[model samples]
Target: MAGGSNTNNYGGDLSEVVRQLAVVAQQLARSSINNGDAQGKLFKKVAQSTPPTYQGELDPTILQNWLREFEKLFGAVGCLENSKVGCTTYYLKGEADLWWQQNEATIRALPGFNWTKFQDKVRDKFYPSFLLKQKAEEFSNLKMEEMSVTKYYTKFIELSRFAKESIAIEKAKARKFESGLTIDLQLKLCGQVFETLDEVYGRAAHLYALELKK
Candidate 1:
């Protein structure tokens, strides 16, 4: 009777251990399925957006535009921060693809690697100093002579990237933009205390419309 009681106790303990193992397995399986489902949804959204492929163009404007498009797509789809570099790099083709394949290990090994870091790497490779300086000069010489206020504003925003320090502050940005407007618009907008670039643009546009009517 004592031997039988000992055997029964051992069997019960074994059974409990098996049950706990089964529960852990089931939990792991469910977690894996949830992760897979999330990845599938993200891929489907990215496909629908038809993200552009990059083929190692050296043009700063082209590179900038490609980066801009991806940024927009990432925002629109609610892309995970950890996944942005993977998604953007997957679109690289030809020379760009080869370049990434070579440097990927090193880039990935860097501390705290992310989308911004990836962007910096790409710019470092493609955006040469001469091209950057040329872009800055273009921004410095920008004027609203022939272009409408809307068009001038668009170009101003686009070229401002190359000359960031010139308009680093909101007041400076407003002043830089105001100075670029046509002489007539400048004369009209001279004594105002505009706090933001948008405010200056709005006032200039309104005045421009009035001048057109006259």
Candidate 2:
């Protein structure tokens, strides 16, 4: 009968629609699983790097070193920008973990929160403004004096972090470093066209060695 033929055609169309929806659901499930697996792999890579733990140390140097270590590891592993705070916070223990837990919700609620913001927050919490100013002053007054070229260079590099803007550019860094060297060394390096701190350091070291021999 014609009526029976119409019912069969309608049922066939309904079944095909259901089948298409089922296929889409399956694809979505597979995509979700793949994404989860990739995230797990990335986290594992971060763990293998053995990132340092922060325990709410009051020492600015310790906090700065810990932050620097994480920065290095993040660069080495090619960590995702969105995931950096999560990864770094995982290494928090003791008082540091407690502080993060207490403030996590509020910090997360802020608009446009990211790694740099996180760094600023941590510094604000741990690094006092007066101490930072003092460190900057020490860097400004640093001089080679009797220190060997290598030792002076080491100190310069260490203190430079506190006064980043002073030597933000290569030429300024070279000039600032040269200004701290002994008068003899400065005279030797004067009127030269050094473009970088490293170039100035190399020439200074070579000159210092020659002076030691003489």
**Candidate 2: minimum summed lDDT over ten consecutive residues — where?**
56-65
Report the error of model 2 at residue 70, Å: 2.9
My TM-score estimates for the predictions, one after another, are 0.80, 0.78
Over 1-214, each residue of candidate 1 has an lDDT whose tens digit, in order, gives: 9999999999999999999999999999999999888877887898788988889887787789999999999899999998788778889998889999999999989999899999999889888889999999999999998999999999999899999998899999999999999998898887898999999999999998988898
TM-score: which candidate is best? Answer: 1
State the lDDT at 82 in candidate 2. 89
- The TM-score between candidate 2 and the true structure equals 0.78
Misplaced by over 4 Å in model 2 are: 1-25, 190-193, 212-214
Residue 164 accuracy (lDDT) in model 1:
95
In the range 42-147, model 2's lDDT, one tens digit per residue, is: 7899899887899988767788999999888889888889888988998989988998999999998789999999988888888998888888999999999999
Each model's lDDT: 0.91, 0.91
